[model samples]
Target: MTTHITGTREEWLAARLELLNAEKELTRRSDELSRRRQELPWVRVDKEYKFETEEGSASLADLFRGRSQLLVYHFMFGPDYKAGCVSCSAIADGFNGIAVHLANHDVTLSAVSRASLAKLLAYRRRMGWTFPWASSGDGRFNFDFNVAFTEEQQREGAVEYNFQRAGHAMDATPVPLPVAQSAAMTGTDATTYSLDRPGLSAFVLEDGVVYHTYSAYARGLDGLWGMYQWLDRAPKGRNETGIWFRRHDEYDRR
Candidate 1:
């Protein structure tokens, strides 16, 4: 009944049927997820968030300009850091080409961090990207999103997360770096703590006001409209996959 290389025609057919059924189950789940996504509700973003751009400070409402929907990519660039977040940077790299299409949907895409406009401009030049990037240098917007903090908050506890080797084993250790140091490392050319978290946020704009519709972090970005996990699963894969990260200075971001 259990021969390694000797299977009846009926047995082979049964195995194939199982595979087909599994595939069908996966498709059904995917369809259900999409339906749920479409049914999700939106929230109002009425906070007084501000952004620092080349033209100077602007409110979150101003970010919409005249659009109906506002999507903010909370880039990691505190005023204390030297550069921006590499993972966030990688995502930002994919925005310029897509901004054209986003504008067509009445949605404007932009990046906000606490880095100064001058620093952002220089880094943008170095990276050879043209997407609209701004700073929250003079505002508490970063803290509002829980991506930033104050001196006291930093002292409480800050265990950076690394995707390459986080929660994979039972004997995991925490890396403790000073708040200033950790914050500074994020925007620099050096590799950062790999096991923190990544997040996504969206806001809705009605009339001349904005509302915090939703905010998602970690793998919550999965299965969204613009999912790109397949590309990272390719043979060459992506830099953030596994223990695969190099200094930004070493990579040809351009």
Candidate 2:
């Protein structure tokens, strides 16, 4: 009754073998790209940025937590939002399990957001997550990192994200349905929701100084969306249409 191609075992194996060769080549190319990312110059971070953590006020360097490297997931929980962005929450769901492993390997993985420390901690408890989440707290940390934007920036088209000047889709008239829906879920309008974007930034500490290494945004974050990586190998393969994901806890509410 299936419409998919029916094949003998031999035929399927032959096709799979051909795909395996391509997959191997892709793996090698991915390795090369990673090496190139590591080779990118690290700019010294001299500007002081403060964060509010569960342990009280902390410096940007402190987030490294004795590790040489730090990976920050620029979470999209703006100061106004009632809750975190659904998409961001989905991406963060995988962080708890990997945090310990990355810590042992000398890389500290934490999430930085514009939300207050209290709000972040409450949400972490709601989601049952223990990964370090810090609040940038009305500081320029998010702006300097290009993950958060201002109302003026949005109005004047001064936003630069993913290393380029780009207009946010949420600004368009008749805002995209998914954007509107997500904004509603966050208890904000589309414009407010769009101000805070999601991204990942890397930093390194050496000789008692911290350096900004690399950052990615937009589709560049695709690889870090753990579900998509698994879905890519599934039969339906991401088969998405108009925001099919939600915060892991929301599914039961439906």
Candidate 3:
């Protein structure tokens, strides 16, 4: 009684072959886009941003960690939050696996957050992640990168996120359900949680100078979320409802 299509072997092969052609075309397009991304102009970073890492304090350049390139995952863990954003945690679960590979390729991968070093370390330990994570709690690094915002920005309704001035969830009188859920999971209210957004930033150190190479926010980060990449190839392609994910540890309990 299943409503799904039931076809002969030959029919299935024909349909799959048609889909294969489209997939190949998409792959070529993705490659070209990547080439264009690398060609984008780099902006020099002059700000003396500092971060609290496990090895005492570190500078933005030091994050390169003897590598020429740095890829920072701007994790959504605000100073006030009790936990990291669940979605961000999900994305971060893949980081530890790839961190060593990227380091060997001369690119250092890291996660930066506004949470305190102690808090970050505690959560990282709970998750059993070995990747380098830094706390930007006392620095303008997160704000400068457009990943973190202030209360004033939320109140004034002048926040520019995802490359445009959009109405933030923090500004909404009644917080949206997804934002509320995420906030509660982070052990914060909607407003405090909304102050932090998810993003990825790329940097390069050349001639003793750090250059901002590229950044992606919101859906632009989808390509890097390993789980979703697999789900996209599944039969139902990210068949999502409202906030269906949890921090990896929470899933088993649920």
lDDT against true structure, model 2 = 0.93
Taken over the whole model, the C-alpha lDDT of each candidate is 0.61, 0.93, 0.92
> What's the true lDDT of residue 71 in model 2?
99
Pull out the clashing pairs in model 2: none
Best by lDDT: 2
Tens digits of lDDT, candidate 1, 1-254:
75546669999899879988988998999899767855678665556767777767788877775788767776666565566655566667667888878878998887776778898898888778877777777676766665554554334434322222234221133333332343344653222322223455677777766767666654565533232466555645443433233334556777
Q: If the candidates were sorted by their lDDT against the true structure, best first, what order would they fall in?
A: 2, 3, 1
lDDT per residue, candidate 2, 1-254, as tens digits? 99999999999999999999999999999999999999999999999999999888999999999999999999999999999999999999999999999999999999999999999999999999999999998999999999999999989978888787765566567799989988998999999999999999999999999999999988899998899999999998999878888888888774
Between the candidate structures 1 and 3, which one is better when assessed by lDDT? 3
Clashes (backbone N, CA, C under 3 Å), per candidate, total 13, 0, 0
Stretches off by above 4 angstroms in model 1 are: 1-42, 158-173, 176-198, 222-228, 231-242, 246-249, 252-254
* TM-score of each candidate structure, all chains considered together: 0.69, 0.96, 0.96
Query: Judged by TM-score, which candidate is best?
Result: 2
Comparison by TM-score, 2 against 3, better one? 2
